[model samples]
Target: MKRLIPLILETLDRGLTRVNPLVAAALWHLRHPTRRGVLKACAALPLLFVLYVLVLIPFTPGIGDIRKAKIEQPARILSADGKLLAEFKPSNREWVKLKDISPNVVNALIATEDHRFYQHFGLDWRRTASAALHTFSGDRQGGSTITQQLARNLYPDEIGRAPTLTRKLKEAITAFKIEALYTKDEILETYLNTVPFLYNAYGIEMAARTYFDKSASELNVLESATLAGMLKGNSYYNPVLNPERALQRRNTVLAQMVKFGKLTPAAYQTLSKKPLRIDFERQTEPPGPAPHFAQQLRKWLAAWADRNDYNLYSDGLVVRTTIDSRLQTMATQAVILQGNQLQGIANAAWGSRAGCSNGKDLLATFLRETPDYRAAKDTGLSDDDALKRVSANRGLVQSVCESKTRVQADFLAMDPRNGQIRAWVGSRDFSQDPFDHVQQARRQPGSTFKPFVYAAAFEAGAKPSDTLLDQPVEIQLAGGEVWRPGDEDEPSERPITLRDGLAYSRNRITAQLMQTVGPNKVARLARAMGVRDSPLEAVPSLALGTSPVTLKEMVSAYGTIANLGGYVEPVMVTRIEDRNGEVLADFAPTPPQQELSADAA
Candidate 1:
């Protein structure tokens, strides 16, 4: 038993010896580190330090030159000898260097945007830390250095940030690269050019030109301050929306300039003495009469740019328009007064009336409610309600509605000899909404159709004094459609002269004349007379202008008639050139075609 006990104790002693060596080996590994591991830690610490100091520490500005081609927009509306009517700057985006952006303007930007601009590197660590602390506390804050902003501005897609560590790291790397490449002045210049000023208004140059009607170099201190103040919040400080607040913000920028030593104390005092009291309402030039001309000019310029494969907004192009200012004024006024009055008379007869017999009271109501009625929407009212409104005041509403008492006028004047549109007014007010009626809207011509009908009759061998039956008649069509034509003032049968028929706008006589001349002959005559879209089947009622036609076609046809049958295609553009004075195109007169006899035309 004793020998067995001794064997057991020896086996246990060997097991304990083996366990101690293994435990010692594990303890040695826990206490000691590898040289490779130590070397890696040393390398990583300096790498992080270097990244903070060299890359993340400094703010860098942006740099890139615009690769834009310069072209000249076409000069539309020209005189016989190629004299210009109006000059246009359609989508003109010129890059004026920062040097030209007055020193006051630069100072204003620096004062309001970055007071400690010169002292900070690519990133202002203190401001960054403050922003971080604020953000951590659920407060919104931004203190991006100019360089970081420049990076974001230059590479919009790449530098889009969401206040994440990854974005910050990327910003730091890009900022360092930008700073290394671009000079401070170049950075500032790029920043100003790329920064957004208003809705779709990118760059300080565009803002200056758009708001002040001047170049950046021509801006005064007040204007500079006002522009600089917009960088923070363009919509919030819009001069058009919040003039008082905008002025106050601008003055604050000026004050900051004085505090930052960018402005002389005396200069600041003078500039800050009073706000630039710009009367938003009255501080504008009266718009000229070439609204339609201007609109067409823009369209042509856009098409020209597209044809040349150029960016209209980015390409710096100077466009000249063809608007005879004097003629435009005359034509616009004529159309406004004469057209409105004619429309009024038409309204008095055909419009819905409340069954009132008094014409004076009806006209009064028309005059009173015309503006509102024109401004109101055409939809949402049921047919019954509309009729009720039209019938109110015993036919007053109906009478007023008949004559076009509301504002709707279109004027188009062109040289019949050359087809150069000299003057045009699309609507009475371009400021209201520039839906150009001159070229866009097609309205019923009423008696205006008589001229073409008469010309057709003359071409068909009917003389000016030819007699036509003015008796009431019913027109029957092959499709079984029946239409009874009547005169406005006469109910009894009568005979009328061709000239008198047109002068009186008699429906029955004109309808009979159409039938005698043949519908095909009249259609052919209408087309040859410059009616771009010819009237449907010389319908019996076409003589009364039941058809729709554009002002351009009407004016073109009328001008041809006045000029004795000579027809020319209207030319809105006269010349096109490049910024370097190179001619691109010069408009030539389209040959005149004789469409009607001398007496007929």
Candidate 2:
């Protein structure tokens, strides 16, 4: 039995030696029964395991190519003041160099994320040992160095984020490779440029802009510490969404910075007392005074990019337009105020209508067409029950289409001298209706077309003082139909001066003048004045502005008169530039075409 036991020990020792020499030595000592030899072998085990890890690191896949990692940057649109109006970050990333980042942010990141960031060679052994002890004791803590986090970010598919020993070993191997390939500053730059902050913000630059409406370089100590705290749990520590939690986390980061000696205790106390002042009003999406203009710019840029072999979403081009932001704001406010007033007037008229006597029935019909009503019905409510529920909401009935009470208006202010569109408001509310009414909707200009007819008469050698008969006129049409054109409310038989007829928008006098100058001449002059989108028929009704014309066309035609009879095509965008500030194109004003004599206009 003694011989069999020794032989069994010898066979076990042989198997252990192939795997671990120190373990085999410990097993051999157990056979000899020496306490000293077993203790010595036990002491060598950790050193032997570390050596084994060091030997296996070079064989890891993609370890040698750490320096060749690439970062994707999204395209950004900036206003004239360099304010970010919009960003097309499909990957939600923007790369900012380490040099561009504030030192306060750097120090905060190191203190919160990795206290021994500078002291470590990719892996902090002391932190790793402490983390190991804590993990075994069922306490959760992380010991990943900044470089290790960077490695996982760069090669997530290769070095997974799974909290397993295998993943940890792979991560350690990749981190060592990154540290060997890049300098400390380079690693930090890559890490800051690659780490996700929250939401769609994927880097320090975007995080800075998203949270503070400022560049990463301009981050203060408090701001830096706040951002650093977000690394722990972004949603839980979001400065805008969870201010109290974020403030606590930020103070914790400040304490960490002080504990690590990155910040003085006095400085930490001062910063910690400060409030979490975040700019919540600054829009992270395409928001500004000119959302319609921004959308127009995006479409134009997309076509231009396709023709030029560029990417509108990834090339980071800077498009400069002629829109004046201040003017745009004023114009938008004016349109909204005027539209609401007009809507109120129309609603008052609607409320007095005989058809509105069936108010309850109309409200029910309107509510039935709404999505909210449908949603309530889908939740097991009957049709009548859903209608009753929707009707109980007072606001829903108030918004019903009482003769389409939602009045929309389009306003455009242009620089008449150069045809530059200074301000443009396409609708009362762009969010509710994205249709650009100014450039798209065709509506009759009513009496506004009188100016064009008068200008044609003046060009035909008729002076403003020339008298025209303001009487009802009956004329023959092309399809053998008789047409009678008259002024609004009543037809005047008095012979009025051309100036009086145009000023009063007298339709009878305009028709008489149109007959004298010839309808074809009037239509030709309207075309010359930049009314080119729709065709104008030479019928008698043309004198009273019966033709459908876009607001843009009317603005351009009127702008010609303001420009002293020169037709300059309206332009919105002035230039485009690449990311490196290289101008790709510069747009000059389209040369004006003289359409009328100044006196005639």
Candidate 3:
């Protein structure tokens, strides 16, 4: 009765004559003794919430300034004549204007992804309320508009969350902020540039160029529809994976476009019926006379990528190699034909003996397991370990036995003045065994060593026409190894001029001359003649091609002579550009430096 008397007094004080009990309670509170405390709590609650919103839980700038994204400079492959050979890949996000994109495309995206894009101030409250109702009713529909998508792609993790009330409030604030900050077209453009289209493929520019080998501006109605359809589920509707699903998705976009009046019904029907035609022309490899050059270039690129910390497959850096395409082609064909001829001769010569045939078959079988068909079995080698176990002399004998083709061939050609690799053949064929015999292989120089020996002699005051005897002679070595040197002309001892010694590649004459001119002196001369590896010491058989030499060193020596004793270091890349169109590296061929006397070399 006292409480009721107090409530009646409070209701009377608030002048609530016809108040219901609930209204009476509100009136009582309005006039109650603790009203000041209740009002203060209400005011403080909103202030604390505002402080939380403004201070700690405000919108964050995600992903930093996108303009600072790192880019690999696209590699530009060029011909010897400086013509563009090929571009490694076209760039993603090469922008196109809204006018350039089909109106239907723009309409379809708006209708499907964000219907109220034009009308809203970056956010729609009515839709937000409906989304809240839908979420409570167990339907989780994302109300992200095209602008929201762009904001997210350019800066994900901002408005995208579990659709909490606080997050929704923040998203609305941020979306409004973005709308105020950027224009409608600007937002749309950003969306086009950052959207992912397919697996490992990003942006509409790359999508258009990759799928149709065309530009976004060049996308026809059907093609635009296809691209639009990819947005629903890029991997699922990818034309490359399931064309039927892609076509159906595309038709859906087209139908939406017609319903929106962006595309006429007639236009949609025509586009839907047209064949999906695209020229899937694979990128052409540079034409080269020396395919071995390509193999070497590939190896060099692999190493370069490792050194430069680039993923060759994923990092979008373009690599340009120094190769004359015409020369590469010539070199490849020459090796292929030569390998075939030699392989035929080897098979025929060893065909009569069952043991040799079996060995050859074993080699052939091993080679067939590889990509190279030219790695025909060499019956001359007893086993894989035989070459390692035997002396060089025995190895030479085995090489000769296997030399039915007597045609061991290896070559290296480079631009003498600039050091650009023009042609290199490792083993007459890359597809045969694919072992890069040129760069990573060592082989006997045969008579090729004589030129270096003679160059040494000439540098030591011997003339080209100097006298030397090409007679057969047995000589005792200082190291107790005895050697008998002979010329192919053979048998009778004959006096031949040093000119003839070099021209005919006579062994005895060169050996006898080595005796006259000490072996150490000859080795020094070989070093001067471009033998980069340590020169072999003078020995009894030094004149008979005992030391091994790489094709690079051999060719450098030959080219030094060809260039009138001028030597130039080889270079491959002319320049490397960064993605932002900045020159990261620029290379120019330097003039030749003199390494040897023209007269001696």
Candidate 4:
């Protein structure tokens, strides 16, 4: 700028030389001014520049509003073993506090970006002057301090990035406000958490994890230097993209550390020669092994966050669930192994003409149960047209006939003592079929309901060794209809023990037991043992498990027997914590209640 002062004096003499004789004569006289005039012009330039920058203070935003500026962070779901199940409403940033960050990262960043970070208020005048000198020689330098860079990052829209004098003025003013409002440590914390790195990574935390598969606190000196060096230009010094450039930049950062007294000269020499090794794996939100479970938990968590006044996507929360991944994986494997055989049997029964006795009728029934057929009917299509329309969609037809085409099952393992659900598999494929059969689908409990009837009878003073005649039972309804059960298997005409009746799933023996104990007693016992979600009809046919009940209810009911007649409601999430590792909520274990006598159970 000093070199341009004489040229500006000369330009005024040429452009206005022809315009006015007196102005050009005055300019010519000013061009050859005294040493005092030259010294005053040079002295007044910086003062004028300061006044011009001070005028931009009013235009600057409320940079001191640190009380409300929140960085959006994604919540995480983890299993009992601390394995990441999925990230809910995931983002590419993790806000790490200054304390959690390794000091090596701080030293590296200060050494490479701003050495006078602690000493400067907002700007380094000495470095700025040198940068100006370098710019004149065609070697540009970034004269903005860390505070200025952070001010730009915090309000990128307000402090525009275009290389204009006006933008720089606002940036400088905002940087001053930020420096006054926040501490040096706060600035560094926000700067490290806000800066962007390669691979959609933001913050030193994410950058460290993206390249090294570790948290910010776990970064070593060499790793910290490599990550800090990328702040110059993320893409240019990306370890995975350009290893040579990254290595060289890392060496420069190491040298800076040695110069700043953070690292010994001997250590720098040894560290600089080490190769850049990255664990670079693109991080994506995995559905985990419990997709259906996680999906259901997500809905519940949304409601929880709503009631608690927190944003599910932006507020960083760690939800610790009762789900054990080991048991979950084992249950998933069990379902796949067992469900395939059941599917084979179903396919062999329905896939061929000989297996399906009423193939046409069954296909018609399954087609009518589909939403596509109902949608076609709603659009004024007749039954034949709707059937034709549904059948035309091969994928839809296959899914509708998934009983034979796809094997779907639900498996839930719970710790009976505390009612903690350890594993939950709601379906074979949550992507293709999301219907959760565990608690959502209400189907007949089949012979599983017999245990409740037997328990009720046992509570009524009937022993397991007691014998009964295994014969078909009949009951006359109030509507004057005689009801007779059509048994799936023929019962032996001999007398059967109460234990054998339940072991063989003998409906006749169960019906006789129901008649002796009464239907109301059985329904009451079922509800008391955690089958309280739906109404259980007090009918005699309930002995055959005719009423529909969810798998969750049946499992809980069975768990009651295992718990020595004590019933406890199943628990899913054990606790929730905030981003700072503070316990926001802790869901204590639910106490168990006695439903029946231990001997009866």
Candidate 5:
């Protein structure tokens, strides 16, 4: 064993000599084992310490890029007039400067969180020592200063929340580094902006607006104390959820302020006695003007960002859309009014049918398709128990069905002159149904597609006064199949003018016109008019608008007719800007494509 030890030591000494000579020499001296050797090894300890310090110096964290520590800002979507349409804040925070926050808030925060905030470089040694002593004496407590907390908030993925000596050491180093990099006010500002408040609120600015319906600068002493108290543990002291505990914490902060000489004892007492007043209505995100259009713009922006290597969420972009706010509101109201009327008729017809009566069977069908029911079945719940469980959740199932079954509508209004989208209504409620029917969904246009067929007939040298038989017509397909087209009323052998056939949406007359012009030509004209995405087959049924097309495409096609002959591609976004107000890009309408002559259109 002694010989093996020498061999191991020799191998380590040789390896260490190539890496670190001081360490290798110490190891060699220890292996030799003499009184002089031991003395020499003791002498080399200071040199080893100096070498260690020198080695770590080059690898120290840099502090030049403080901007990298800034929290994410929400991107704003604006209308043509610069009115806010929607704001996409995934982090749900609004950054505010330290100077903007009330002095009362700053005082309350310093008193409660870190009394020696100004005196200490980064870590408060006196508080840390006291906290460590308390921990050793069995009352465990945290000794982190505001700087330490700020460091953790900025780099949570690195300095984690694990209660270990290693994590604490890293946190201390980061805190000291932060102090070296930024001023006290800067640290305070970053901390206030990064800290999480309860109810999904992050940062003092968001918390202030959420609870008080006022800006951080407008907060009074009591309000300031209330917000500061949440820094301890926001979930435990949430004003909305636990008012009593929040009140106690607020009083504690006020008391700390008195102790720190930031507030007088009489003022503290008076503030502590006041009741906590929070406006709950202000907590939720404000409803925007055009959500569907915003969502569609978000998708387009996302694709543009990917192609251009830009960030949509963090980079504070100002997206200027072509939406007219007044027109959008009117369009939304129209869709709601018309959709409700249609929904009432539909509900009266089908909502009270046999299987749908009382909605029990529908609820059961929905519940059976749920993951909870499947989990219950998988976990050995008997059929009877599963049924009981489903019965217990009948109200929830019913609510879900009602929400899903609400009548949806889509509307789009565009300027035929410039192809700028004036207004768009994608669905009844964007929260319930995010599906953009105008841009994303394809539905049968009914008789709305008749204009293209008539335009094709005119292009094929048929006049508006040209007459066609308004009778039932049967056409044979290539595969020996027959298609019989008819109008809503009884068949009439009377002739109708091409203009009247299109005006009344006459099916048989339009079918005869489609045959005269050729169905492929009609489809070609539809594409030229901006119905580009959905392919149209040259079938005889195309005359009666059997093919599915989006509302956006229909609007653009009709817009072409309204413009007399030229087709203009629809324009939504007008421009985009960066955080510093630099215009990144501007959008313009595509050059008009002539689909038909002026008289033909």
Candidate 6:
């Protein structure tokens, strides 16, 4: 039995020598390799088990994988003229270098959380022993160093947050790997940049901006202390939501600085008494110009990212659009100005109950559709009672009236030469009303369709001087009903030339001409000229622009005419590149097609 015991101890020592030497030392004594040696081994069995998990089980690989860890960045949306339109960040963080971070914050963090940060390799043996003593006395204390915390922060699922011995050992192994791969300053830089803060913010840069409305470099001593204190618990020490607790935590951080000689005692005493005075503007990315255009482009870019196996939010893409910033500004301003005038005219007509179109109270109809009224009804209130309950609030009634009376407009401009979209204004204000009217709303072309009808006649070899009678016309319909067309203005009172007929917008003259060339001919020409998607009914009324088509299709048709009968799809995004300026994708206008003869166009 004695010979078997030594042999078994020799095998265990060889296995543990490759993982940890302390386990092998405690496992056996060569002079007395017996039952006594097994009793000594039990003292370090927990460590033996941890080492087994670390190397033998291979829960994770090595430092090579840790080097691949990266912080996510938002995509930059830029205009053609090099103007920053907006930013799209899902996590809402901005990365800043370690040099930009305040020294006060660094001092406070090191002194309070890990005083022996530079002295220890990763685990502070003195603090660990003291923590063990405290745990034995029923006073549990966390002895994790900054690097250890950073390990768990970088790989939460791998290292884990559970307060178990196995998780702690895994965290320690990762910390050692991190220490071997990076310098002390590099570790500090990553640790500060990665930690989370309150208000949907991550990293010191965003936290500084969120709490103090200042950049990370511009943080003062008090502001730095306040931010450093938040590392313990973000919302628990939030200056915006819980100021009293935040104040107490901030003073504690200041005391640590004084103890570590980073701050003078007199300064700490004076600073500690001061109230927590943060500017406290919850920082959010601005919804900049051409937000409507950028939103659609984002979807296309998202699809591209998915196909290429990249994350749109984290890959740090730069999208350069074809929209001119100056033209976009002018277009947005024009819509706002014209929309306000139209809104005023509409409000003046409907502001009073007497001036209503059908003498109906528009306010009552608007209020009945409100969620408040619906909720009141759902709670068993009658219609009349729900109306009274909702109407009691004057603000709600005024907002509803304003919303119903508002005038919405959309504008778009594209380059005729290459079909590049120069400017786009989707609405008067994207925030108040996000409904895009340019690509989505279908509006009647009205007199705009007159020119396309003239094109069809010219293609049939009809001259501009060719005359048609400018008078009312009657025809038989498929439903066996009489169809008569009237003129908006009094007909020229005689036969008029095709040019004069177009100039006067003579509805009857155009309708009569629709019969001469055939309705099918005009529709075939309309679709060829860019009215491709909307169904065009081949009727006499088609010449009068009775069919509704998308503004994009109409704009495309107009662009085709200007391009001398050549059609090209409008371009929005010109190119997208990765963070290192490497081109990921480039887009151009679609290939041109001759839809109409140059002479007819």
Local error of candidate 5 at 235, Å?
10
Cα lDDT, all candidates: 0.69, 0.81, 0.65, 0.85, 0.83, 0.83
Highest TM-score, which number?
6
**TM-score of predicted model 2?**
0.55
lDDT of 5: 0.83
lDDT of 4 by residue, 85-144 (tens): 878863577788999999999999999889999999988899988988998899988898
Error of 1 at 360 (Å): 9.5
Model 6: worst 10 consecutive residues (lDDT sum): 351-360
Off by over 4 Å in 4: 1-70, 90-285, 352-405, 486-493
lDDT of 1 by residue, 1-601 (tens): 9798657656655675578977555444434558876787688997887776566333322333211211223333343344444444332344568888877778888887776667766777888899889998999787777778776765555655576765676576666666666677876787777777664556777777667777778878889899898877889989878888898898889889888887788987788777664322222223444666666766777787789775455444444445566777788788778866765665455443332233465544554455434323265565445444554644445455444445577777888888888778888677764788877888888888778888888887888788876677788977999888777665456567898988877788888887787777766777787887645556677767877888898888887887689888887766665556576667777788898778776
TM-score of each: 0.58, 0.55, 0.49, 0.55, 0.65, 0.66
Per-residue CA lDDT of candidate 3, range 1-601, in tens? 9699877776475675465667767665665649686888798999988887676344544222333222323345555656454444333345566677656556767766777788888776677678768988999776766766665565456556664666655555555666776678866766776688754456676677778887777777787788888887888987876888888888888888777667898888788886655433222234334445555665666687688776443355544456666775577677668876766676566663221332444434433343222222243444443433322334333443453333445666688777777656777644444566776777667778777777777777888777765466778876777788775566455567888888877788888877777777766666665677745756646676688777887777777788877877767666655544466556788877676678987
Per-residue lDDT of candidate 5, residues 1-601 (tens digit): 9799889998998898999989998897787789987788799998986776555433434464235556455678888877899887766677888899999999999999998999998889999999999999999998999999987887776767788765776677778888987889999999998888866788888898888988899999999999999888988998989999999999999999999999999897688889999875445565577888887877888898778776777778888889989899899999889988877776676464221333356656766777777878998999668756765775655565555456779899899988998888898877667788999999888788888888888887888898987787889998999988787699788889988898888888888888888888999999998799998987888878889989899888888888988899898888889888999998877778888788888
lDDT of 6 at 347: 67
Provide the global lDDT of candidate 3 against the true structure.
0.65
Best candidate, lDDT: 4
For model 5, give the 10-residue run with minimal summed lDDT. Answer: 350-359
Alpha-carbon deviation at 412 in model 4, angstroms? 0.4
Which one wins by TM-score: 4 or 5? Answer: 5
Flag regions of model 1 displaced more than 4 Å.
1-108, 115-230, 236-286, 311-326, 329-410, 427-435, 457-467, 476-506, 517-525, 533-538, 559-567, 592-600
